[model samples]
Target: MLANPATALELDHVSRHFDGRAVLSDISLSIPAGKITCLLGQSGCGKSTLLRIISGVDRPDPGGRVLVGGTEVAGPGRFVEPEDRRIGFMFQDYALFPHLSVADNLAFGLRHLSRPERRERVAKVVERIGLGHLLDRYPHSLSGGEQQRVALARALAPRPSILLMDEPFSNLDQGLRERVRRETVDILRETGTTAIMVTHDPQEALAVGDMIVLMRAGRIEQVGTPFEIYDRPCSAYAAEFMGPCNRLTGLWSQGRIETPIGAFRADLDMPDGALALACIRPQALSIGPDGQGISARVMAKTFTGESEQIDIMVHPLAQTLRMHSHVRIPMGIGDKVSLQLNGAQVHVFPEEPGTDDPLDQS
Candidate 1:
C-alpha cells in the first residue's frame, strides 16, 4: 500500500488575476491534514482556479503564498513545478492515456524507480485498489465507473502527499455517481489521504467533505462543517445557496421578528422598528388542521415522489408560502389549513437596501 503521510495545506492571501480582472480575491484558508476539503461554488466562481493554484498548475498573483506540510511551494520569490510538488490530480474527465493499459497507466509516474521497483509498486497499488483483473484493459474498454476507479488508483499509486479532484464524478450517471462517490470517499478515508475536491453540487460537498469552503464571485462566502454551513449560514446569499428558502419581510421588535406567519424569536442588534428579513426553509413549515396554528388556504400542491410541496396563501401575506412534507397532504385547492413554523430553522437578517420585497413580485 502507498505509505506517504497526508499533508496539511495553507493558502495565505492567495489571489489570482486574468486580464487584470480579479478572479480570486485575498483567499486565506488552512486545510487540515488527512481530511477532505471541498471547494464548492457555481461555475466561474474561481473554485477550479484555486484548485489549479494549489496543484501548482497555475500561479497566484504577487503577495500570495501556497504551502503544503508547512513548506512553501509557491510565493513571490520562489516557485515549485507541478511534478515536484508531490501532488496527484484526478481530472473531471479521468484523463487516462487511450493507448496505455491500466497497468501501464498506474506505472507512468513511477519512471523514477528501477524496473523491479516499478513493477513492485504497480503490483501493490493494483492489489490495494482491486484492479489486478483489469490491468491489461485499455481506457476505452472500461466503463465510466471502472475508468473512474482506474483514475483514482492511478492517482493514489504515486502515494501523493495531497490529492486534488476536479468534479471527479460529474460524468457518471446519477445512480452510478452516488455509488462511485461513496466508494471514493471510503478509499480516501481508509488511506488517510488529504484531498481537496472542487464541485458545484452542494449535496455532493455536504455528503463527502469534512470541511466546505463556499465561494462566490471570486471571494470566500463561508467556510464551515456541512451542518454549520447549512443550518447557520452567515449571509442570506449563503443560506439560499445551500437550499430553497422562503424569504419573508418583517419588522424587528424586542428580540423577535414579526411577520405575516407569526412572531419568531430572533436575537439581533437592530432597533425595534428596523426592517428584517426572515428566511425559512420549506421543510421548516408544518401543515396541520385548521385552528391549530396560523390559518391559511391551500393554493397548490406538487407531488415530488418522496415529498409533497404545498403552497398556501396565509391570510395576512400577499404571496403564497411553500412548505415541503414527506407525508401526503390531503388538502385540495382552497382548503383551509394551518401552518406552524419551526423556530430552529427560521433565520433573520437585517434587510438591506435593494433587497427584494417578498410581497412585490410585480
Candidate 2:
C-alpha cells in the first residue's frame, strides 16, 4: 500500500538489463495524482524501455517495484500482467486496427465489462474526443488526426487510472503536431488523468508536461518544471540539451570564469582553480558595434523569421560564436561587432567527463 495517497504512480529502484547490458540504472520516481509528467531524453536514453517497465510489458531486474494507487503491481516477487494493471497505453503509431471500425476499436478494451457497459463506455469516449461522426469509419479511411483520436478514445474507454503515451504525435507533420498536442493536453486536463509521455523533443516536453524528468545515458539527470529545467539546469548536459548554447571553459576563481570573450561571473560553488564551463544561450548574446562587450567580426548572417543567426569570430578568442539577435543590425561580412551577454540567461556547470563540450586548454 502507498504511504501517500496523493501519489498516483510510483517506481522504486527500477532497473532494466538486457544481455548483460544495463539499460536503466536504479531509477526512482513518484508521480503526483492528476498531473501530466513527461519522460524526456534523447534516442537510446532508455526512455522507451522505462515506459515498458511502467506498463508491466517488461519486467525489471530483481530490485524494482512499481506501484499504482498505493497497490504494488510489480516487484522482486510480485508480478502483474499489462492488462491487469489497468493502465492505458498509446503507441507511437497509434496502433489502431485497420480492419476495425472506430467504435469497434474503442470498445475493444471495454470487453471486461458487460456488453451494455462496453457500448456505453465506448460511446462516452467517442463523445469526449468529439469523434462521434467517425464511429462507423475504419482506420484506413480516416486521416492521421482522426486515427489518432480513435486510438486515444480506445485507450481512454477503459478509464485506466494512469495513461502512458510513447511519442504519440511523432507521425504527424509539424503543423498538425502542434494542434494535436494542444487538443490532447486540454482533454487530459479536463479529465484530470495522471499521464506520462515519453518523448525526445525538448520543446514538446515543456509544452505538454507539468513536470519533466530528463534522462541521459540511462540515468536520471534532473527533474523539474519547464522553467526550472530550462532556466536553472542542474548540469552542463542539461543546459546544452535544452537548447543551443555557446560553451566556454575556464578556471573557477572568485565566482568568475576568465574567457577570451572576457571573464564573467558564473556563480558556481566549486573549489578555486577547478575547471568549469559557461553555457551562454544564443539569445543571451546581443550584437552592437559601439557596445561595452566582447569585440568580434561578423562572419555570416542567416535570416530566420523574427531573428537572424549571427555567426561571428571573436577577435580576442579566435573562435567563431553563434548568436540569435532580434536587433536588426545591418552589418555585412567582416564588419567589426561587439557581443554582450545577458547574465540572467546564461548557465554554468562544473566540468564533467563525457559532456558535449570540452574547455580549450590551448
Candidate 3:
C-alpha cells in the first residue's frame, strides 16, 4: 500500500432526489488527500445514499459530481459505472459470496491483474487482516468479525484509491467493534488509502475518521475533527446527537447565562437579555451536598465508576438537571442536592423562534 498525495476527493453541490423527495441537498465538501472522512448521521439521514452515489451504484441528478483524484466520475446526466470508477465499497452486511472461500473472495475483484500479482495481493491483505488461517474456509464458517475483515481485505485487494464502508462494523459486538474499529483505522493509515464511511455511531465516526461530517435530512450540518465537533457543536442537534450533553434554556446576560441551576459566566460572548440555550458536557459539571449553589433534589442516580450521573430536580423552576460526579455519592432518589457549573466556558445557541423542539424541521 503506497501513499499517494495526489489522490484527493471532492463533492460539489451534490443533490439527489427520488420520487419528488430530496434525499440530499446542495452538499459540497472536499476531502483532503490521503485522509479518511466519515459521514455521520442516523438512519435515513442520506449518508448511505450519498455514499452510493459516490460509488457510482446510484446516480444523482444535475450538479452532483464525485471527483476522485481530481477527475469527475459522476455528474449531471453522466456516471462512470461502479466498476469503472475504481472505488472499493464494503457493504454493511459484509456481502461476501457464501460459496466462495476467503481466498477466492479476496481475489474476486483482482481478475484484471496477473495471476501471481493477484495471489500476492490477496495473501498480503488476508494476512494483514488476520484471516490467514481461514483463507480456505467459506463465508458461512467465519464469525461476524472475521467476515468483516474478509470483506475489507477483498475491497483493499483491488488497490482502489478510495474505500467506502457502509456501517462495516455494525454486526460486531461492542467490544469487538472497538477492537476492529481501531485495527481498521490503523490498517487504513498504514496503507494510506483514503476512505469515506457512513455510520450512525458518533463514537465510531470519531474513532475511525480523521474528519467527520454530520449529515441531516440529506444536508451537511457540520464538518470538523471529532474533538471540535463534540466540544463545540454548531447546532442543538449536533450537540445532542454527538454525545451526552445537558442542554438548558436560559436568559443570556452580559457574558453570562442564568439557568435553573444558576448563573454562570461564558467565554463566548452573547447578547444581553437574549433567550438562549446552553449546552454543557456532562463531564464539565460537578456535584456536592446542598450548599450555596442552586438547590435541587436528586431524582435518580447511575454509577459509571469513573463518573456517576446524578439526575436532579431543580427547585422553584422544577427543571431536571443532570450532573456528573467522580465520587460515589450515596444520595438516593428524592434526596436534596445542589449542583454547580465548574467551568468558565459553555456553548450557547440563540433560542429558535417558534416551537421549542429544535428538531421540528427535521
Candidate 4:
C-alpha cells in the first residue's frame, strides 16, 4: 500500500513544449489527498498533456517541478522514471495483455512479492471488484465493461501512490458507461486513493469529480468544486463550456444591466457603460404572465426528450436578441411568449477588448 501523505500531488510552474510550440503554459495545480480531481477541456486544450506529465510519461520543461506526496519527482537536475514514481495509469485504451489471464495480468506488478503473497493480493482485488469467478478468464473473453473493471483491479492491485485515468469509460455504450462510471467512483471513494481523470464531457466531470480543473488554450480556466464552477463561472467562455446559455449584450450601471428584454440586476464592478454579457442558463428562463415579462416571438421549437428548447427573438431591445430557453410550454412557432429569468444566481462577465459579442457570430 502507498504511504499516507497529507498532500497527494503538487506542480510548481509546470510547462511543456514541442518543436518551438508551447502545448502547456506555466500550469500549477495542488491536488488534495484521497480526493478525485478531474482535468476537463476540449481537444488540444493541454489536458491530456498535463496528465501525461503527472504520470511521468511526459516530462516538463526545465525549471518545472512535479511533486508526489511532498517528494520531488521531477525538477531541474532531478528526474523520476515512470515506474519509480509509483503511479498507476489507466490509458485511453485498456492496454490489457491479450495473452495473459485476468489473474496473471493483476499479478504483473507484484513481482517483488512471494508467490503466495502475489496470489493473495490478486484474489483480494478480484473479489473486491466482484470478479473472482472471472479471474481465470482471458481479456478477449470478457465484455468491455468487464475488461474495464479488470483493468481497474490490476491498477489498484499494487496500490500505487496515485492513479491517472484518461477517458477511461469512453469505449462503452452510454448506458453501460454511466453504470460503470458510478461504480468506479464509488470504489475510488471507498478506497480513499488520490485519483485524477481526464475527460471532455462536462456532465461526466460534474458527476464524478470532487474538484474540477477546467482548462482552455493550454491554460487553466477555472478551478473549483463542480457546483462552484457551474453556478459561478468566471468568464463567458467558462460559462459556455459548462452548458448551453443565452447571452445578452448590455450596458452595466448601478449593479444592473439594461437590456431589450428587461432591466435585470447584475453583480459587477465595471464602470458605467462598460460592455458585458448577461449569461442566462437554459433552465433559468420560466414562462411568466403575459403582461409582466419580456415579450418574445418564438422562432423555433425543438422537442428534446425531457424538456422543450424554445428559440425566441426578443424584440424592442437595442438589437434582436436570439435566446434559447429549455422549458415545458405547449407553444408553437410564431407564438408570443413572456419569459422571466429566475435563478439562484446570475452570471455576468466583463467583455474583453477587441472581442465580439457572443451572439454576434450566432
lDDT of model number 3 = 0.82
- lDDT per model vs. reference: 0.90, 0.86, 0.82, 0.84
User: Per-prediction count of colliding residue pairs?
Assistant: 0, 0, 0, 0
Model 1: residues with Cα > 4 Å off, grouped in runs: 1-7, 354-362
lDDT of 3 by residue, 1-362 (tens): 23235557778899989998999999998887677899998777899999988888888778777787777888866678989987999999989999889889999999999999998998889777888899899999998878888888899998888899998888899999888888888889988888998988888888878899999878999999998888878877788778776777899888777887666666555678888877777766766678757677788888888888888776665556677878788778887766667553356777765523323334
Pairs of residues at least 3 apart in sequence or in different chains that clash in candidate 3: none
Q: What TM-score does model 1 achieve against the real structure?
A: 0.94
Worst 10 residues of 1 by lDDT: 353-362
Better of 2 and 3 by lDDT: 2
Q: After superposition, how far is residue 169 of candidate 1 from its true place, in Å?
A: 0.8
Residue 120 Cα positional deviation in candidate 3, in Å, after optimal superposition = 1.7
lDDT tens digits, residues 179-217, model 2?
988999999999998899999888999999999999987
Where does candidate 1 clash, by residue pair? none
Residue 301's lDDT in candidate 2: 90
Give the per-residue lDDT of model 4 (tens digit) for 232-345.
898887788887777778888887777666667767788998887777776776655456687776777777676677676677554333334445677678877787776544
Stretches > 4 Å off in candidate 2: 356-362
| Models ranked on TM-score | 2, 1, 4, 3
Residue 53 lDDT in candidate 1? 98
